[model samples]
Target: MTILIIAQLTIQETQRRRILWLGLLMAISFLAVFGIGLHYIVAELDAIDMDRENMEIATGLLLSAGLYVVNFLIIMMTVLTSVTAISGEIDSHTIDTILTKPVRRWEVVLGKWLGFVGLLIVYVALLSGGLMLVFYLRTGFTISNVLAGSSMMILQGLAVLS
Candidate 1:
């Protein structure tokens, strides 16, 4: 019961932050631009006459670079979000109100962590879906392995946070 209440409040508080919305919008815009750029770059590369092995190697490198960019962006966003979450409340003295409640401190910590985890999960899912769509449209192939690998990276992030 306490965990639920804390989780709900944490989520509500996170939702109330204007920075969160801004970050989300910025991420979406970034993804779109990156996708278009990648599509054009790949198309240009494909136009060059190279041996099958060379072409495959070049394509793999290009896709790997794209995946690296996506990974970096997602990690940066997650770190920004998580680092700010509780510190923001404390800075504003908003945590005092919660501290005065019957809840334990550990509950507050855990709940906030869980709330941030939920937020990160949603962000990652949307970004991954966007990347998959872009890759499919541009190359006629879906990088399931890249998606899975990114998912592991996200989970590793969550583990580190906990």
Candidate 2:
């Protein structure tokens, strides 16, 4: 219960600070730009009558490259959020308010971790899912093992979130 309360409060704090909004906005814009580029590139390739094997290779490279960028963004976002979690509250004396509650310090930490994990999961789903969706809808193709692939990205983020 204590952990849940702290998690709820941290999520609220994130909203109040507008970090969540900014991240969502950035994700949306990134998706839009990437989708446009991908569509036009695929159309150009089709217009040139690119062979199947070469076209597949080109699209595969493009998708992987985009995913690499997404992974980098995830890692950077994780670092940014972690840097601000406890330390930011301490610097601003907001930790005092949380500590004054009948909450153990460990509970506070765990709660923050819970909140962050939830937030990052949502982020990964939106960005990665949208990327994959665009790739498929634009090209009539699907990546293999999407579940395992996305799980790996979450684990990558968890490494830094820890």
Candidate 3:
């Protein structure tokens, strides 16, 4: 119960941060650039009447590159978001207040970590899935290893989070 409460509070605190909003805006802009560039490239390929085989390969390569960028972004975001979670509270003397609560120290630690991890997981899913959907819509192609690739990205983020 205490852990859950702390987790909820952590989520709320992070949600209220200006950094979160800034990060989101940057992400949207990044996706826009990627999407527009890809659309133009695909249009040029269509003008040349590229064969299906080449198109499929090209689409797959694009997905891989896009996901690679997303992977780095997620990793960086996770690091930045978590860097201040504990230290900030300590500096602000907020840790004193939380320590006086009924919750154990470990509970506080675990709750904050879990809360951030949950948030990052949702973020990764939405960005990756949205990009993949855009790719599919723009070109009737799908990466053969999309599921596996996404899972790996998530794992990589978690690894860095720890």
Candidate 4:
């Protein structure tokens, strides 16, 4: 219960700082750009009478590239948010207040870490799923093994985060 309270507070603090909001705003815009670009690319591909085989190749490359970019952003954001949450509190002397409480230091740290981990998971799901959905809607091509791909990406993120 204490850990959960701390975790909730940590999330609220980041929201109060506008970190999560800004990250989400940026991600939405990124998806919008990808969607627009995909629209144009698909139109051109159809206009050129591209065969299904070549079309699949083109779409596959685009999805792979987009997925890679999302993965990279996830790793970067995890690092950035982690640094800001930890060192920012320290520099602002907010950590002093947290430590003055009844909670253990490890509980404080773990709670904050859990809050960020939750954010990362949501971020990955939204961005990767959004990108793939855009790709499919624009091209009529579904990604093969989405479950496997997303799981791998999540694992990669966890590895980088730790």
Top candidate on TM-score is 3
What is the per-residue lDDT of model 3 for residues 1-162, given as tens digits with 9 covering 90 to 100?
888888889989988988777777777887888889889989988999999999888877887789888888888888888889999999999999999977799999999988988888887887888788788889978667777877887888889878
lDDT for 40 in candidate 4 is: 90
Which of 2 and 3 is ahead in TM-score? 3
User: How well does model 4 score by local distance difference test?
Assistant: 0.82
The C-alpha lDDT values of all candidates are: 0.74, 0.85, 0.85, 0.82
lDDT of 1 at 58: 67
Which parts of model 2 have CA positions greater than 4 angstroms off?
none
Cα lDDT tens digits for candidate 4, 1-162: 777888888778777766567778878888899899878987899999999999999978888888888887788777767677777889999999988988898898788878877777888899899998898888888877887877787787777666
Q: Is 3 or 4 the stronger prediction by TM-score?
A: 3
Question: Model 3 off-target regions past 4 Å?
Answer: none
Candidates' TM-scores?
A: 0.81, 0.92, 0.95, 0.89
Candidate ordering by TM-score (highest first) = 3, 2, 4, 1
RMSD of each: 2.5, 1.4, 1.1, 1.7
What is candidate 1's local distance difference test score? Answer: 0.74
